[model samples]
Target chain A: MKDALLREIGKVVIPFIQIFGIYIILNGHLSPGGGFSGGTILGVSLIMHKLIEEPYKSRIKISERAVMQFTCVSLILYGLLKGYSFITGGGEFELLDIPLGIPGRILSGGMLLPLNVAVGIIVCFTIYTFYTLFDKGEI
Target chain B: MAAAANFPLLIILILFLSSFMMPVLKRVKAVKWLSLSSILLCVVLSVLTLAYVQQNGAFLYKVGHFEAPWGNELKIGYLEAIMSIMFTSIAALITWASFFSADYEIKEKNIMLYYTLCGMLLASLLGILYSNDIFNCFVFIELSSIAACGIVVVKDKKENIKAGVKYLILSSLGSGLVLMGIAFLYSITGNLNIGFIHQELVKVKDLYHNTLIISLGLFTVGLGVKSAMFPVHIWLPDAHTYAPSSSSALLSSLVLKAYILLYIKIIYRVFGIEIVKTLPILEIVLVMGAVGMIFGSILALLQKDLKRMIAYSSVAQIGYIFFGIGLGNILGLMAAIFHIISHALTKSALFLIAGNIIERIHSKEISRLKGIGIEMPITLGVFVVCALSMVGIPLFAGFNSKWNFALAIIDSNRILFIAVLVASSLLNALYYLPIIINAYFGEENTKDRVYMSKEKSLGALLPILILAFAIIYLGISSNGIIDLIAKSVSNL
Candidate 1:
C-alpha cells in the first residue's frame, strides 16, 4: 500500500468524510441523517484509513479493549437513561424539564440528541471492532 | 400484585443488562456468579409472577406509559408463567453445571463471552414468551437466533464454526420469511398488536380470506423452519452436535421450544382456535409430525457419535410435540405443553451426562465409551435414568406424556397415530437402551481403561442428579401436572 497517489488522496479525503459524519450526527434530530447513517459514514472513514496504511498502526492507536469499553459504556448509558425515564414514569419533557428549544434547532428533540450520539458511537465502534476481529481473531 | 405483574419486564431488563456487564467482570468466576445469581433471581420473580397471574387472572403490563394498542406490552398468563419458570430454571441448572466443565470445554478468554451469550439467550426467550406484539416477537426471535449462533461458535473449533455458519444462514432465511409473514399480517390487519390484529381479522374474516391463508402458510413455513420441524431440520443435527455440551443442552432443550411456543400462541391466541380448526394446516402438521418422529429416530439409530444420536433423537421428540398440536383437541394440546417440560428436563440431563462422559474419555463415539461408565457410575446412572424416561417407560415423565397423547387420539379417527407413537417408543428404546447396556456391560475387555475417570465434580454431578430426580418426580407426580396442564389448556 505504498502507492503515493492513493495515500495522498486518502489523507486529503478522510478528514472531510469524518467531519461530515460528525455534522450529520450532530444535526440528526433536525434533519434526515441520523445515528445509523452518520455512524456508518464515520466507520467508513476508519475503513479508508485501514486501506491506506498497511498495518494500520501509526495514525490509529485504539486498541480492541478501548473500543469495547467505549461501545459498552455508550450502550449502557443509553439503557440507563431510558430506564430512568421508565421508572420515573415521566414524559421526555417532564423527566429533563428542559425546554424543547426552537423547533428546528439541534436541541429540539429532547433526549434524542444524547441517544443519537450514543447510538452513533455504538454503530461506529461495532463496525471497526468487527474489522479488527476478522482481520485478526481478537476483539 | 401490581409490582409482581411487572416481573416480565424486569426479567428481560435484568438479563439483557447482565449480558453487557459480563465483559466488565473480566474474572471468570465473577462473570459466572453474576449470571447465575441474575438467573436465579429471575426464576424467583417468575414464580411470584406465575402465582400472581394464576390468582389474579391474565394481565397486560405496558412498556413505558403508552396504552396497550399504541405501545409494547407484556402479556402474562398461566402458560407464560409456567414457560418462564421452565426456561429460567433449566438455564440456571445448565449454567451451574457448565461452570465447572466450561474451563475444560472452552478457551480461557471466551468463557465470559459464553456466559454473556447465555444471558442474552435467556432474555430473548423470556421476551418471546412475554411479548404481546407480533413485531416485538419477531425482534426477540432474531435476537435469540444470533445469541444461539454465538453459543455454538464460541467453542472455537473448526467443526463448530462450520456448524455455526450453516445454522446462521438457514435460520436467517427462516427469520426473513417470518418477517415477510409478519408484514403480511400487519398490512392486512393494520395492527402490530396480536390482540388488535385478531380483533380486526375476526371482523374482516370474509373479505381477506385468501390473504389470511397466505399469511398462515408463511407463518407455518417460517416458524416450522426455525423450530427445526421435519424437512428443514438439516442444520440442527450439526449445530447441536458441534456446539459445547452445555450449549447443546440449551439449544436443544429450550431455544427450539421458544419458537414453538410463539407459533402456538400465534395460532391459538392470535388466530383463535375455531378459525384454525377450519384450516387444513393442522392435518398437514399431523402428517409431518408422524413422519418426523419415525425418520428422526431411525436416523438416530444410525449415528455412532453420541451427540449426533441425541441430536437426532431431539428431532423425533420435537415431532411428538408437533403431533400433539396437530391433534386439535384439548387433551392433545395438554400433552404438547407437558411434553415440552418433560423433554426439556430429560434432554438437558442427557446432554449434560454426555458431556460428563465425553469429558472423561475425550471421545464422542458411543462405541469408545464402553466400560467408562464403571469409572463414572453416577453420571452413567443418570444417563440410564434419563434414557428410561426417553423410552417412555412407565413412571418416567416421557411415559405420561406419551400416554396422554395415546388417550387423546384413542377415540378419534387418528388412532393410527397411537400405533405410531408406540412404535416410536420402541424405536427410541432400540437406539438408547443399547447405549446404556454398552456403557455398563460392554467395557470388561477393553484396553483403553486409562481414559476412565474415577471421580466426577460436584458441580457437574449436582445438576445431573437434580434433573434426573426431577424427571422421576415428574413421572410419579404426573397426575398433578396433568391437572395443571388441563387448566392451562382450558384457559387457552
Candidate 2:
C-alpha cells in the first residue's frame, strides 16, 4: 500500500480510469456500459487512491457522513424522478416532457441520462463506502 | 374519484421514497415520525382505494406509458384492495408500537436503519401484493426477502445474526426457485403477465403438461418455504425468536402472509383451477397442511421461549391457511383468505404483547412470566383475548377461521380432516392455556407481583389493544368479511 512505484503508477492511471467511467456513464443510453459498471470503475479508482496515498497526507478526503449524505441525496432524487415519470406516463399527462435529443447523441434519451447519472453517483459512493468500511472498519 | 386509482402506485412510491430519507435526517424523532406518518398516509390511501374498488370493480392500472403485455401493471381488485388495507393498517400499528420500544431493543444508531428497513419491507410487501406481472412480483419477492432479512439482523446481536443468516440463505433459495419457475413459465408461454400466461397456458395445456406441472411445483414449494409452510418452516422459529419484537410482529403477521397471497395468485390467477385440478398437487398440499397443523402445535408446546412458541403457532396457523387452499374448492380458498386476515390480526397482537412482556421483564422464558398479569394486567388481558382466539374459543376471530375451515372441509367431503382441526385446536390450547393460567392465577405465581407495575405506556399498548378489539370485532361480525372474501374468491 505504501510502495512508491505503485503510487506513482496510480497517480498516472487513476485520472484515466475516472474519465472513462464518466464517459461510460454519460453515454450509457447509447452504449453498453452504464451506471453500475462505470460507477464500479470509478469506485475502483477511488479505492486505489486510498490504498496508494498516505492516510494523512492525501489531498482529497471524503468523510463517512459526506458519503452517506451524497448517497441519500442521489437516491431521493432518483426516486422522485422515476416517480414523476411514472405518474406522468401512467396518467397520460403531457406535462413538462424532457425533449429527447437525436437518438445517437450523448445527451439523448430524455430522462434516462439523468437517471443514469444519479445511479452512477449512488453506486460510486456505495462502493467507496463498502471498501472503506471493509478496509478500516470505520467510514 | 379517478385519482383514487393511482393510490396503489402512490402508496408504494411514498414508502420507498420516505425510506431513503430516514438515513439522511439527523434527528431520530424526525425519522420515526416520517416513517409513521407516511405509513398512515398509505393506510388512508388504501382505504380510499378499497372504497373505490367497492363502488366500481377490479381494474388494472398501467405502470407507465406502455400497455399490459409490455409494461408492468398493478391489478387492484376486491382482494388486493382489502389486502392493501390490512397490510398498511397493521404495519402502521406496528410502527406506532415500535416508536416506544425500538429504542430499548435496538442500538441507538441502528434505530434509523431499522425504520428504513421496515419501510422498505412494507413497500416491497405491497409490491408483491399488487403486481400483476409475474416477473414484477419476482422482483418484489427478492426485495421483500432482503428487507425481511435486514429487519431480522438489525437487532445486531449474535443470535440475531445467526438466525438472520439462516433465514437469508433459505429465503434466497426460495426466491431462486421462484425465479426458475418464472423462467419455466416464460419459456413456455412467452409472457410474464399473469392474465396472458393464463391465456397462453389454456391454449397449450395439453402440449406442455409436464412443464406446467414442474412450474407449478416450483411455485408451491418456493412460496411454501417463504410462507413457513409445513416442512420448510425450520428457519422461522429462530429468526422470529431473535428479531426485535416489532420486527417479529411484522415478520409473523405481514411478511409471510404476502408470500402466501403471492402463492394464491400463482395458483388461482396464473394457473387457473381447471388446469390445477388435473394435477395431484392439491392432495399433497392437503396432506402437508394437515400434518403441519398437528406438528407445528406439538413443536410450539415444547419451546421454553415465549416468542419461539408463538412463531411455531404461526406455522400451525399457516397450516390452516394451506389446508383451505388444498381443499381445492371455493369455500376452502375463502377460508384461507379469511384466515390470512384473522391470523394477521391475532398473531401481530400476540407478538407485540410478547414484546411488551420482554421489554418489561427483560426475559423471554415462559417460566419467568409467572403472574405477569398481576404486574401488567392490561397487557396480559389482551394476551388472554389473543390466546383464546388462538384456541378457537367461540366468538373469537380464531374460532371463525376454524369454523370456516370445518365448513370448507365438510363441503369438500374431507370430514376426516375435521378431526385434525379439532386435534390441532386442542394442541393450540395445550400450549397457550398454560401461559395464561400461570400469568393470572396460582398462589406461587402471584405472591410477589405488584399491580400494574410492568405495564407499557398507554401509547405503546394502544396498538395492541386496537388489534385485540379488531379481533373481537371480527369475531362478532365476521359475516360481512366472509361475504367480502366470498366476493373476492368468486372474482378469482
Candidate 3:
C-alpha cells in the first residue's frame, strides 16, 4: 500500500479528465453534453484538484463575490432582453441580424452556441465557488 | 406549405438550447448575455408569426410533414397566436425580473436546471396554445408538468424538495388520466388531429359516444387538478409557496391557463357545441368554477403565509377562467383570455413584491410584516396597484375583464354566476386587502430591530413596478390588447 511511482498515474489522469470536461463543454450543443453536463464534469475536476494539489491552492481558484456578481448580472441581462421584447413589437427572443448558418457546422444553430457557452461559464464558476464557500462552512 | 407554420418549434428549441448552456459558462460569463438574446429572439419570432398568421388567417401545421387528414397536426390559428402573445410576454417578464431578485448561497447548485425548467415551461405552454392535435397537446401538457415540478425543486431546500415531489406525483397521475382521455378520443375518430376529430364528431351523432364523454370527464379532472380547481387543490399552496420566486410567478401566470385552454378547446372543438348545447354538463363547469371562486378566497383568508395566500388567490382566479369558458359566449371567452393577462400581470406583481418582502423581513407571515409599507414604501405602493388590479378597481386592467366576464355570464342565462363572481372578488379583497393593511397601515412592531436593506430590494422591486404600471396602461389603452383577444376569440 506504500505510494510509489503509482502517484504519477494520478498526475497524468487529472489532465486527461480536464480534457474530457472541455470536450463535453464545447460539444454540448451538437452532441449530448454542453454547459450543464460539462460544467459539472469540470466542477468535479476541481474537487480532484483540491484532493491532490493541497487545500490552500484551491483558494485562488474562485472567489465567492465573483460568483455572486456573475449570478446577479446574468439574471439582470436576461431580464433586460425580455423587457425589450415586451416594449417592442417583434419576436420574444430578439436575435441580431446574424444569418442562420448551415445546420451542420459547429458554429451553426443560430444563438445556441453562444448561449451554451454562457451557461457553461456560469455553471462551472458557480459550482467551483460553492465548493470553496461550503468547504469552509462559510455562508 | 401550411406545415411551415411551425414557428413555435423554433422557439422551443431556442429555450432548450439556452437552458442546456447555462451550467458551464462561468469562465466566459457570456451566458448571461446569450440567455437574454435567446428570449429576445423568441419575441421577434412570435411577432413575425403573428403577422404571418394574421395575413393568411388560420393554418394547420402537420408536424414532421404528416398530412392533416390522417396523422397528427399542430393548429396555428388566430386563437393560438393571441395565446402565444400572452404566455411569451409573461415569460419574458418573469425571466427579466429573475435577474435582480435572486443571488444566494447555492448560486450554481441548480441554476441550469432552473433555467431549463423555465424554458420548458414556456415552450410547453406555447405548444399547448398552438397544437391542434390532441395527443400532441397531451405531450406538451406532460412537458409543462415536469418542468413546473422541476422549478419547484430547483432550490433544493427541504421544503421546496417536498413540495416538488408532491406536485410531481399529483401531476403525473393527472397526466396519465389526461393521456387516457386522449386515447379514448382517438379510438372514436381513428385520428388524433383536432380538426379531423371535429369533423368526425359532427358526422356521427348516433349512439354511445359515452366513452368520449367519459374521457372528457377524465380530462376535466386531470386538468382541474393542474388548475388547482377547488376540491382537489390540495398540493397547490405548498408547491407554489415553496418554489423559487420566479417559478411561482410563472405557475400563477401561465401554467394553469394552458390546461384551462385545453378544456376550452376540447369542449368547443373536440365535442363541438352541437352536442354540448344539449348536455347539461355546462352546468357542471359553471358550478365547479363558482365553488373554486368562493373557496379559494376563503382559504386565502385563513393563510398566514404570503405565498400560500397568493396561491389560494390563484385558485380563485382560475375559477374566473373556467367561469368565462363555461359561459360559452365569444365575449366570455374573450374576457377569460383577457383576464388571463390581467391576472398574470397582477399576480406576478404581487409575488415579485412578496419576494422582496421575504428578502427584507425574512418571513412570509403577514403578522411579522408590520408597517413594512413605511419601510419599503415603493414596494407597498406597487402592491397596492396590483391589488387594485386584482379586485377590478376602476383604472387597472382587471376591471375591463371582470366587467366583460360578468356580462358574459348574464348573456348566457347564468346570471346567478355573476353573484358568485362578485362575491369572490370581494372575498379576494378581504384576504389580500388585509395584507395591504398590515403592511401599509399597521402599527410598527416595537421589538425586533430589523436593519432594513434599502438597496437589497431593488432587483425584485423594479420589475413589479413596471407591471403595476402596465395594469394601468392596459386598463386605459386596453383597446388594442382587447381587440387582439376579441379577434382571437371570434376566430375560435
- For candidate 1 chain B, the 10 contiguous residues with the lowest summed lDDT are B443-452
Descending-DockQ candidate ranking: 2, 1, 3
Q: Candidate 2 deviates by what RMSD?
A: 1.3
Which predicted model would earn the best lDDT?
Answer: 2
DockQ, candidate 1, comes to 0.32
Q: After superposing candidate 1, which stretches have Cα over 4 Å from the reference?
A: A3-16, A53-59, A86-108, A130-139, B442-452
| TM-score of the second chain, cand. 3 | 0.93
C-alpha RMSD values across all candidates? 2.7, 1.3, 8.5
Give candidate 3's root-mean-square deviation (CA, Å). 8.5
Q: Looking at the true structure's interface, with contacts defined as alpha carbon pairs within 8 Å between chains A and B, what fraction does model 3 recover?
A: 0.00
Off by over 4 Å in 2: A54-57
CA deviation > 4 Å runs, candidate 3: A1-139, B1-6, B27-29, B70-72, B105-107, B442-460
Give a tens-digit lDDT track for model 2, residues B28-68.
Answer: 99999999999999999999999999998899988888899
lDDT per residue, candidate 3, B169-200, as tens digits? Answer: 99888888888888887777777888888787
Per-model TM values vs. the true structure: 0.94, 0.98, 0.76
The DockQ-based CAPRI class assigned to model 3 is incorrect
Count of backbone collisions within predicted model 3? 37
lDDT (C-alpha) at residue B446 in model 1: 41
